[model samples]
Target: MADRLLDAMARSASRLYGGEAVSELEHALQCAELARAAGADEELQLACLLHDVGRYAVDPSLVFDTGEPSRAGPHARGHHEVGAELLAPWVPERVAWCVRAHADAKRYLCATEPDYFARLSAASRHTLRLQGGVMTAVEVARLAVHPWLPDALALRRWDDGAKVVGKATRPLSAWAPLIRRCFDR
Candidate 1:
């Protein structure tokens, strides 16, 4: 399973989102590096690494082809929910929850933090509009109580920063041990 997951990531590494500066693998590795630097537990770091896996898991044609409006929803089947479901069989509940909520975490931060929206990359900003935009006051208050919100928000921050072009990090193979360690078995 671990090898399969790594292979999928490698296969999708060259596929870039419309506005993201980094390829999918680079973003994932960078996010994992950020989580490790912050001393996050293995599960959180793994969550950061795989939060966007759904983009690879789903039909690439659905994600990359912009002709259909139905395919453009950021939280559609192409986003967090599919990734979380894919990881749930192997990963911790915390990791799955973080992946599931990372998109919402972005909305939460944009609503609650000043200048947070402005800090988003152009691609992210474009997707944010598709992702229900900023959270309303009520939505913000609702998400504040989620147990996984902090981890999700942290992952979101890492996700945002992981777009650095040409940033170097450990190879994808270097993460296999951590990925194996976190597998639920």
Candidate 2:
């Protein structure tokens, strides 16, 4: 299962989301690197690495090829939920929860932090509106106590910073052992 999952990531590595300087794999590797640099636990690192797997899982034709704001429909299965669901069988619940909530964490941060929204990349900012825009006060109150909120928020920070063009990082294969370990348990 781990091999198959990693293989899928490898196959989709070159497919780029419009406007992003980095490919999906690059973003994933960078996010994972950020987590590791911050001394995050293995599960958190894995969560960061796999948070966007759902984008690859879905039909590529359905994904927006342009930088335009993505609309709801096929894209709404949400890379977050899809990735979490894919990893749920093998990973810790905390890891799955982090993957699932990362998108909402973005929305949460955009609402609660004054400068956060402005810091978002153009693609991210566009997706934000499509992702239900800023959270309502009620939504904020509910997410405040979520068990995985902090990790999700942390992952979001890494996700945002991972889009550097031509940034160097370890290859995807380097992550296999960690991914296998998460699955092995």
TM values, all candidates:
0.88, 0.89
For residues 89-168, could you state the per-residue lDDT of candidate 2 as single tens digits?
98889988998888799999998999999898888887777567899999999999987788999999999999888999
Cα lDDT of model 1 by residue, 117-183, tens digit: 9898777777677667899999999989988788999999998889889999999989988876766
> How many residue pairs clash (N, CA or C atoms closer than 3 angstroms) in each of the candidate models, in the order given?
0, 0
Model 1: lDDT of residue 89: 86
Show where candidate 2 strays beyond 4 Å. 60-76
Q: Clash pairs of candidate 1?
A: none
Taken over the whole model, the C-alpha lDDT of each candidate is 0.81, 0.82
Model 1 ranges with Cα > 4 A deviation: 61-78, 182-184
Model 1 TM-score, all chains together = 0.88
Local error of candidate 1 at residue 83 (angstroms): 1.0
Error of 2 at 2 (Å): 1.1
